[model samples]
Target: MSVFAGRFDGRVAVVTGGASGLGRETARRIAAEGGAAVLWDIDPDWLEEARKDVGAAHAIAFDVRDNAAVSSAAAETVARFGRIDILVNSAGITGATAPVQDFPVDSWLQVFAVNTHGLFYCCRAVIPQMIAQGYGRIVNVASVAGKEGNPNACAYSASKAAVIGFTKSLGKELATSGVIANAVTPATFESPILQQLPQSQVDYMRSKIPMGRLGDVRETAAMVCFMASEECSFTTAATFDTSGGRTTF
Candidate 1:
């Protein structure tokens, strides 16, 4: 919470799933700090409302699972803002909470489509832009469930684990480049995504946290904002933990 009041002055960011959850809050923080944010979301109405509330530079309605759409949005974002200094892949979904045997194949695919495939599409579309500028930040929003698999949430957990792996590989590939890539594993937070979970699941998550509660959006966003800034130059392909002491490793 220290004031980096103009930390992002003249910067541009592309935030996926920016209409709500941690994405929205991160967009707000960036815009408030003087960066131009291009908010992308699957919900047209929600995206528009976020643009208005955050005063984002652009509001894009698109599905990240669609490679073409992600590519087009990246192009449009660069055209409008000139450069994409930061990329935050915060969009994800928790598929039906059920055991692997009981989990619908369709639901599993859908979860991976958004959480894994969507992330790949967004990063693929923008990494070249970051490399061209000789400087950029990519923050992939993963979950602690990835590291410690949650029972009955096979799809969600596996997808996030893939995210972590992808980020690690990307970090190594970009090691010598100016662009840095990292992933954050946040424990259960009071975000819109929580609504998708049953009360039992939610409570079970909270119970594991050493802090005995969920993390706040601002706390998670603060870590993300830092990772997205010039201050994060030395770290890449790293996993940041915002898990309220639940993850000591």
Candidate 2:
């Protein structure tokens, strides 16, 4: 049963990275609350399964790193759903764990390509639709490392910081346009993304959290859902922190 029944009764949400992790969790919550979630991910097989699990209105598999693909997906969504009321940019990657001096240039670029540029593409493609409709909510999933850089994880840290900066600029630009944009900074969390990192790196992150525990995806999803809701009326261009007390600012 939905705790906030009818909160998203008529809304349509487009969630990137919806195949797994926080994206999937958020989509599940939105659908439970009556929103028509449209799941987007780079994996078609996983995307199809998630579409059934989340009860999504649609599921499209495409690379967010490709602006043309992102644009096409946005148009397809508008064509089928009539309008997009929310966008949750949850697609990201954790590049190879290495010191700045040893970090592979290719790894750094790929991280930015997905974690930063992919997000930009999604926002660019969808914002026009939101503007035409006079209302929309955008929640970009950033990271606590973005605020305080993590050792040996230079690319992920820098890319997320860029996400925060980009969100601020976009929020200000759309402030008066009836489209609200915000970013969420989460601490080390129990997520599939963690699997991409080595145990030592994970342990290092866990050590930094004052709470001494990884955040549950549900906790972060709760924050995202609220920000995606019409109830988030007064906040825009702000960073909502879910860093388990790791980041107070």
Candidate 3:
């Protein structure tokens, strides 16, 4: 038997944006520890890839922005897995980087649609199920940019900052309950999302981190897994930093 043989044997986990980046890595780790994972993503192609990678997990091609879709996915996940024990809100978009004056209203809206509203939708869908079970672990993926706003990425920064606030508030709301909620703020990590940015912009982001290097998605995933694990019984409503010395305190 594996070391984590029964660490999460009967638990069900849902990872939004589980097709790639930190979400993919988190799902992979959870499965390795014997948890059943429900991978939710809009990318059908990558969703297949993630399913093959996770083995025995369910994949749902759903957009987090649609309330009904999110609700349906959550319901289906519970039907398949029996209970929702963990949730990682990882679906997010880095909106167009530009000055506030040049920022497009639609772009800003899109950022919030995924980064903030999407998270809320997932939480709304899953919280009752968690409450029913009297146990749940939630990890919201925010960014160091959220903690200390980043220039040229107003929408992305603001949306993530709102996520942090939301996590804190929900954590408190469930403080007396058995549910635990927290957010992880990572510095720039090596992920496919970086391909969307210009070289100069990427370099600027790298320069801001005192660690002088980008974080690995696995590192971020590890922190997230720890928070989601039963081992983390305390430490709710906190912002756990994996920012590599960026935005310290």
Candidate 4:
């Protein structure tokens, strides 16, 4: 049982990339706390598995890169759950690990498509619902790479940096709307996204942490849950770090 039991008794949450990794864990936590979690992912099969594994209220399969699809998903969620109280943008991709000079153009664009543009689309679609309800919380899962750019990960780093900036602007815009927006920058951690990188790249990120260890997803989830709750009322347009002591700013 969650210590935050009943905190989200009547809330509804939409977590992108919810089939696995940070998104999946965050959804799990939200559901445990009594929130209705609506999971969105690109894979139908994985999404079903996650729905079962996380005990989500519902699941939708679609790429967040598609604005129409995101908008439709938002509508579908509200149709099923009545309101959207939380949205966690956690879908992302790390493009080819190569110096900027050698990076594949296609891979770079694809990274932005998923990591940056996709996040933007989801935010755009959900903001209207949140605004209509006069309440909502948005948590964009950025990365420490966004703060302290990692070598050979230009697309990923730059895109996440964009996420941080976007969240700041969003939070400020929604400050008085009773809708809150924030970004979380996590250091290297155990997640499916890690599998996309080379061991050397992973080691490089792990080495930058002063704590000498990667983060735990539950730790990130704890921070996310707080930010996605009414308890986070006072803060907006801020960046929360979970970099295991890697980022001081």
Deviation in angstroms for 58 in model 1?
Answer: 0.8
Which 10-residue span in candidate 4 carries the lowest summed lDDT? 63-72
| lDDT of candidate 4 over 161-241, digit per residue (tens) | 999999999999999999999999999889998889999999998889999988899999999999999999989999999
Task: Please give, for residues 1-249, the per-residue lDDT of candidate 3 as tens digits.
Answer: 335555777788999999998899888888888999889999899899889987638999989999999999999998877899999999999989889999999999999999999999999999998998899999999999899998999999999999999999999999878999999999999998888677787899899999899999989988998899899888899999998898876
List CA RMSD, all candidates.
Answer: 1.0, 0.6, 1.4, 0.6
Between the candidate structures 1 and 3, which one is better when assessed by lDDT?
1
- Candidate 4: Cα lDDT at 97: 97
Clashes of each: 0, 0, 0, 0
| lDDT, residue 117, model 2 | 96
- Candidate 1: where are CA atoms >4 Å away? none
Encode model 1's per-residue lDDT on 16-41: one tens digit a residue. 99999999999999998889999999
Off by over 4 Å in 3: 1-5
* CA deviation > 4 Å runs, candidate 2: none
lDDT of 1 at 226: 95
TM-score of 3: 0.97
By TM-score, the better pick of 3 and 4 is: 4
Best by lDDT: 2
Cα RMSD, model 1: 1.0
- Ten-residue stretch with the least lDDT total in model 2: 240-249
lDDT (Cα, 0-100) at 36 in candidate 4: 95
